[model samples]
Target chain A: MKKSSLILASAGALLLMAGVYLAFFVAPDAVVRIDDRELVRYSQKIFYFHVPVAETSFVFLLLGGLFGAMYLGTRKRSYEQMSYAAVEVGFIFVLLVMITGVLWTRADWGVWWEWEPRLTTFLVLTLMYSGYFVLRSSVQEESAKARFGAIFSIIAAVNVPLTFVAGRLDSLKPVHPTVFTLQGASMEGPMLAAFLVSMFGMLLFATSLYIMRLDLLRAREDIEYLKEELEVG
Target chain B: MAAGKQVFAIVKKDVLAELRTKEMVIAMLLFVILAMVVFSQAFGVILNDLDRVGGGLLWVAFLFMSMLGLNRSFVHEKDEGCLEGLLMSPIDRPLIFFGKMLGNLLFLSIVELFAVPIFFVLFRLELGASMAGIFLATIFLSNVGIASVGTLLSTISINTKTRDLMLPILFLPVIIPLLIAAVSATGGIMSGEELTEVYRSMRFIAVYDIIFLLVAYALYDYVISE
Candidate 1:
């Protein structure tokens, strides 16, 4: 890694460690209602990291779309790399969010999964990006692959809101709790501080990971180009 | 010829070709009926739950059947290098996209028309005379939405190595919203619910159709590139 990237990555690592410390050690536990007659004592700690990671995944995917459009317009290989990198980082963050989300859901709701709007929307988004990777792998020619990937990212970006609406509409039909009990409820001072710290830390971690992925892709492309050149020479 | 005329000319040519072969619709109908049979057999014991399951089955059948047509829609062009010819033609790319999309929509609608009635008969369910109009409207809106997106994706995926398999993987997720609305509206009508209750999903379908149609129309140019 380059000097700047190494510094950034280590800084991100340090911040995330600190943030986790804050989340577990400093944050207070709170009681939440799961059903009409039941209450569960839950640690509100996960929300700080979970919400940021989830929201950051959206940002990374959006960047994927934006860079994808740029690649489509310019036909530049670098933009394609950026788009792919953004999606790779976003996909990891999304997986983390899902793991954390499911754990938190199980803790609070006593069930592992619910067809809630946000959860369903994220699931579809993950599927779409997985499809994006599948598309990327299927095409042989480099330029065609880039163009197809770019087109897919753009399409997936558009599908996100539609998926949200559809998921929300489905949620309205079933009589389950549409809202996660802890979400949007106010937090205490230490809880708010920890949430903010973790949120910033997660975003930094996501961006640093994106940079690392981009650098790795670039190096791979360079090595491949050199190999081909050697064969031709 | 003008672009609009060229679009129709391609549509007409495709329709005439389909009329001659009768293969696309036949395959689509056969696939759909097969799916219906499988679903009925699988859900055989639970006759009471057909009302809930039938609408979802209907949309899945439509979606898979449409895939058959969409896959076939590009074969002739790909086989004889007619896609190259079209690209070399004076007409614009979006026009060609519109032509093929319209052709796919027509064939898909025909398959739906055939499959829906057979599905009702095989499953022993009814859309009711009053609910039939709303169900058809939902079908229409969702078909256009799927057709538009499917056309663009099929064109892109056909060039890939796994031509046939890639289309569905890329297609199903994109059309989730349309499927959501269509299945909900169909389910509502089947359950003897008021039209007012289902109108929201219908509106969602209509909006999905319009927005995706526009997106596909614009993006089709990039998708068909050599």
Candidate 2:
């Protein structure tokens, strides 16, 4: 990583650690009442990390789509690299969201998975972006690969939100389908502070990673260009 | 000639080709019917209360069968250099997309028309006469969404190396939302549920179709161009 990205990444790591400390040590435990019993819900702690990660993934994917459209409109190589890097970073976050989401569900709901609206939407989003990589690999031509990838990214971005909306429809007859209760509903001052810290940290960390990946992609292209120049000379 | 005329000419050519060969529709019909039979044997017992779940089987069969047809739709154009010819012609790229989409929509509807009746008979279910129009409307709207998105994606997939295998990978995920809405609507209609709920799903399918159609329209030129 370059100096700027390294610094950003370090700051992000520090804030995230602080967020963790605040979340566990400072924030009051979430209490759930079962009939007459008050019980501390430990799994609620995961909310600080899980929600921020999920939101960060969505932002990156949305940026992936926006950058893709920009690349398509301009046919600029820099835009294409930015688009690809965004999707790649966004894809990592998407998987992290999936894993954390599953663990959270299992911990809180005592089930491995639920076909709830939010989960179902995220599942489809995962599948769609997975298709994006498959699509990028299937084409051999360079410009065509970039073009197709950009197009699919834009489609997937648009389609992900639509999938979320569609999930809310009673069409899947979701066993009285309701979205999983977002656990952040009970946040107090400490919890809020921790969440904000984590959210900013996650965003900065993701941006740093995106920049690093973008630089790597551009460097790879440059090396290829240099090799071609030597071969021609 | 007018854009409408050009589009119709493209559609007409596909119709004539299909009429002459009877290949795409016949194979689709065969695949669809066989899939229903497979469903019966696979889920042989306790399928009696299949009204609600029947939507799942029906869509899986149609979605796959549509992919088969969609791949075939573009294979001929690409194999015979017809896509190049289409590009070289005077018609607009978006017009070409609409033309091909209409052709696909027609074929999918026809196959479903035959297959759905056979599905009802084999499964021993009656949609009752009154709800037939609504059921068909749901199927038709779903088909429109399928054809629009399928046509656009199929155009892209055919250009890639893994021509035959690529369409399903790209198309299925993109179409899942529409599929969910379709299943909800059809299931609602079959279970003799509220008309209002069924209409909502149908409206969703319609919105999906319009959104994809507009997307394809704006993007097809870039897709088909070099």
Each candidate's fnat: 0.66, 0.62
lDDT of 2 at A174: 51
Residue B79's lDDT in candidate 1: 83
Question: Taking the tens digit of each residue's C-alpha lDDT, what string does model 1 give over A95-177?
Answer: 88889888988876689998777777777777888999999999999888988999899899889889888866652544333
- Predicted structure 1: lDDT: 0.83
Output DockQ, candidate 2: 0.78
**How does residue A68 of candidate 1 score in lDDT?**
92
Measured with C-alpha atoms, the lDDT of residue A122 in candidate 1 is 75
CA-only RMSD, every prediction:
2.7, 2.2
Candidate topping lDDT: 2
